[model samples]
Target: MIVTSAPRTKQILREVWRPLALLFVWDVVVTVVYFVLPFRAPSLPLTLFGSVLALFLGFRSNSAYQRWWEGRGLWGLMINASRNLARAARNFLPDGEAVDLKRTIVLRQIAYVHALRCQLRRQSPDQEVLRFLSRGEADFALARTNVANGIVDGTGRRIELARSKGWIDTIQQSSMERVLIDIANAQGGMERLKNTPLPVQYRLVPTLFTHIFCVLLPIGLVETLGVATPLGSTVAGLMFLAALAIGDDLVDPFANTVHDLPLNAMCRTIEIDLLQSIGDPAPDPAAPDKQGVLW
Candidate 1:
């Protein structure tokens, strides 16, 4: 999602401001209480709490990163699968009445790529996906709840038809079909990542604990830091809260966030690869922007 050389300080501020604000508010409240009833700093073991929080944050970050990595890996597999399918189409099917059918199948694979991207992001595939399909095919895919799955089903059906008509023999059909199945597996893997979220504890527990530790941190430091407690607490709170925010963003990698996989660009890549194989005009691949962000 976020592909910049460095995320802007302003953007970082935007993400952690809420927690920072709470830290500031809580710090002020606690400061006033500190004056009323001077704090016994050593009474609260800040070191022990900090260690526990560190372990939790590490676990949470690792979990979210795994999900993000899995989604990216699935897309990598999809890209390879698309290329394989295109290669098979050009080689397996004999050039004749089946030419149109081969073209349709190859083109629809592009549609399937775009459709799956849209599906995972919970977006309408109207403009992007429809263009890849014929009027009738587009209309059918658009009407369906799971457009990507429908397109894949159509692909399998086309394979069957091509086999029955002897455009491709059983062996060729089976080989091409194997690539289709790999693509399907990649699709299913991404869909699972999109549908199944990180566990509830992963979502809630660390965040709650992080906030608790942040709020209590300044209180424990009141006696030692005195007037500097607020500043120290604010900095510490922002750091921990920012980490939590990043983990939260990464956990749902298909939500089309800045930190998400570059699905649009990746779909375009599949389009260019498959279309080029069929001697069709395809768009040039795009590069990351000047800041090396948002490719």
Candidate 2:
């Protein structure tokens, strides 16, 4: 995610330059046709059209931002649940064989967060997840279609085993299980956002109308603006186009784009906190890159 106060001008230009150039060229052609041919600028209801288009773009932008925010909220839930589960494992589970079990649970919580991050981004978790698990256990978890869910199931079994061995009482087991359920709910919400896209009409209609409005902008304005129509029309067209772009950028919060949630940084945070809970040497928190982005 971009952590800067404002995104760089270079980055904004890089994203929109192609469409901006096309709009400029189209505006110029419309202006030239008005002057060279015996054509009359149509009295298009540009103000009314612009108002309706703004409404459409506004609704789409709001919906996209809500999806982005929901994804962020889900990750926050996961982070807190991870820390709680690790803390419970360290405090509630008794020592002896349970000491090793406590360590296992803590490390596996870290693994689970990283695995969930990878699963959201549609990447392999092998490199980030395996180091935290035993070879046999990692193999078993990775063999499943949903690796993160598999890890959560394994953790639940371990918690139950501790209860059976009298390392933790039934009440303690139930509390930790509640945290796991929260984690699972958060993951399910994230998967729902990632798998289900915005309605096709929301995406398709606004884009089509935005481009069509831009194409007709100069033709409608050429009568009064004359040679200045290209400049005026291009600027107006860009506003609508940029609004359209914002919705697309924010629609998928887990696409691994610069606009996405800082999942990698957030996973590392869980790792550091969980490791420290068990008196292990934890790594430093993740820092943004030179571009002011965390991934």
Candidate 3:
């Protein structure tokens, strides 16, 4: 995600420059046509159109931002659930045989988060996930269609094993299982967001209306503004264009884009906390790039 307080002007210009340039050229052409021809000035109800268009853009932006925030909230839930599971395993499991089992469970929790991150991004988890698991276990998890869910299932079975061996009592096992359920619920929410998208009308209608307004902007204002029609119309149209871009950029939070959530950084955070809890050496915290983007 972009960690900067605000987006750089260069980036914004880059995204909109092509269309803005076209609009500027179109505005100039319209102004020239109006002055050269002896045609009557077209009177479009621009005020009414602008008001209705603003409402549509506003709704679209709000809906997209809600989806983005929900995705981040779900990840927050997963992070807490992961920590709780690791803490429970470290404390509840007995010493002796359970020592190795505790370490395995903690590491696997790290693997599970990474796998879920990769899964949400539609990436292969082989690099981020395999190193944390035993050869047999890794094969078992990777063989499944949903590698992250498989890891959670394996962890559940391991917890049950610890209970059967008397490493943890039934009550303690139940507590750990509750944490796993929370993790599952968070994963489900993320999946739903990634798979489902904002309705087509929300995406298509605002954009179409915005462009229509822009094309008609200079025509409607040419008689009043004269030579200044291009400048005034383009500026007003640019606002609506930028508003449309905001909704598009934020609609898919899981996408591998600067506007999307920093899933990689978040996964590394879980790794660091869980590893350090078990006295293992963990990687340093993730830092943003020179441009202040965290990935």
Q: What's each prediction's TM-score? A: 0.94, 0.98, 0.97
* Range of the 10 consecutive residues with the lowest summed lDDT in candidate 2: 7-16
Candidate 2 on 59-156: residue-level lDDT in tens?
99999999999999999999999999988998898777789999988988899989988998999988777889988877778888999998999999
Clashes of each: 5, 0, 0
Give the candidate order by descending lDDT. Answer: 3, 2, 1
- Greater-lDDT candidate between 2 and 3: 3
Lowest lDDT 10-mer window, candidate 1? 286-295
Query: Candidate 2 has what TM-score?
Result: 0.98
Off by over 4 Å in 3: none
Q: Judged by lDDT relative to the true structure, which candidate is superior, 1 or 2?
A: 2
Per-model CA lDDT versus the true structure? 0.84, 0.91, 0.92
lDDT of 1 by residue, 1-295 (tens): 5666665788788888887998988887777788777555556887898888888888999988999999999999999999988888888888888899889889989999988888899988877776878778777667788888888888888999999998889999889889888988988898888889888888888989998899789888887777778888888888788888878878888888767888888988999989889998999886676646553
| Candidate 3 Cα deviation (angstroms), residue 211 | 1.0
Best by lDDT, which number? 3
Clashing pairs in 3: none
Which candidate do you rate higher for TM-score, 1 or 2? 2
Rank candidates, TM-score, best first.
Answer: 2, 3, 1
